[model samples]
Target: MDTKQLNYYAEQDKILIATDCIIFGFDNQSIKLLVFKRRIAPFAGKWSLIGSFVKKDESVKNAAKRVLTDITGLENVFMKQLKVYGSVDRDPGDRCITVGQYALIRIEDQDIELVEKHGAVWYDLDKMPDLVLDHNQLVEDALVQLRLKASYQPIGFELLPEKFTIPSLQKLYESIYQKQFDNRNFRKKIIALDILTKLEEKDKTSSKKGAYLYKFNRKKYDKLADAGINFKL
Candidate 1:
């Protein structure tokens, strides 16, 4: 390295880069958030999202995944970058900028023991407690993204099991949007999308006649999505 280059680099501002994740899970009837009580200083014992400072050798996306895996013990889940929060005074301790990301997981698929070990709790979206720093804003942004994505794509399938009934799928959308959908209309729209495969089997737990089982046709969805078809619900 050249001495002049090193000298010029040393004169620039040094800032901290951090990543915060907003993990969302669906429990069939409602959407929930994974949060934990802060165990470190600067807000110890208060509710907060899973987060950590980006390591020198790790990318921001990897940092978020690492933090989520360390806390939830889950891997290969659906995650995406939301946006950056760089308010000058967002972090009281230092000049830190955070890249926000959101993840979607099936609530029943998580490792409960691991979550408990980290003191993480899943709270219903509408009933969550006050959060630390700008975390409240982070959750709001993630939810907005989730709803918008769900409107035009089958991203909500990430929160559902491999096999689910039409009613179950409808309930998931209703919960995400916090509104009730006409059962017949919802089913008609979803079926028209041609992205679901009807199975011979049925889920009998919900009714005497039992609801027929269906699986998301990812291949079909992808083909249609590429053609600019919207999966609005």
Candidate 2:
């Protein structure tokens, strides 16, 4: 170890880094964002995104994953880096920068007790409360990224269960886009994609006649994705 080099580097300014997650889920109707009330000063009791400071041995992605797991108790979910927010006054607590990450998880799959323990609440994306410290901007950017990715990838499936009706799937898309889609066209396009496996079972809850249940074929989607197929819907 070079003592001189260590001493010289020790004089540099130290900046704190944090990872804030924009967690999205579908509740069979609308897309929801998970947030909790701030527990500390400078915005205490205000809505804020779940986050954690990066540990010395962890990367920003890992920190974000840790935050997600702590809050939701689910892992290996769809997560992506949205952007880095380094505005000088973004954090009033300190000179800090935050790496924004967005994640998609099935609403029914999260740990309900854990969420309650942290005072986390799910708010509809369109009706979310104003978040603290530039967190609202983070949410806006994440939604844009989500819509763009859903246009080309089947990533929206992450927010759904294993088996779902076509109508329910259509509802999920409509909630994401915040608009109505033609029922016939949506069904036709989804079937043409050939990424779903039609099951013999039917979901009778939605209707007396029942709608056929389908599951997303991950292997088939992987092959199609590798073949440069686009899932624009």
RMSD of each: 1.8, 1.5
Q: What are the lDDT scores of the predictions, listed in order? A: 0.92, 0.93
lDDT of 1 by residue, 33-108 (tens): 9999988778999999989999999999999989888877889999999999999999887899999999999888
Cα lDDT tens digits, model 2, 118-231, are 999999987899999999999999999999999899889999999999999999999887789999999999999899999999999867999999999999999999999988
Q: Runs in model 2 with CA error above 4 Å?
A: 1-8
* Prediction-by-prediction clash tally: 0, 0
Best by TM-score: 2
Q: Stretches of candidate 1 above 4 Å error?
A: 1-8
Residue pairs with backbone atoms closer than 3 Å in model 1 (clashes): none
If scored against the real structure, what TM-score would every candidate get? 0.94, 0.96
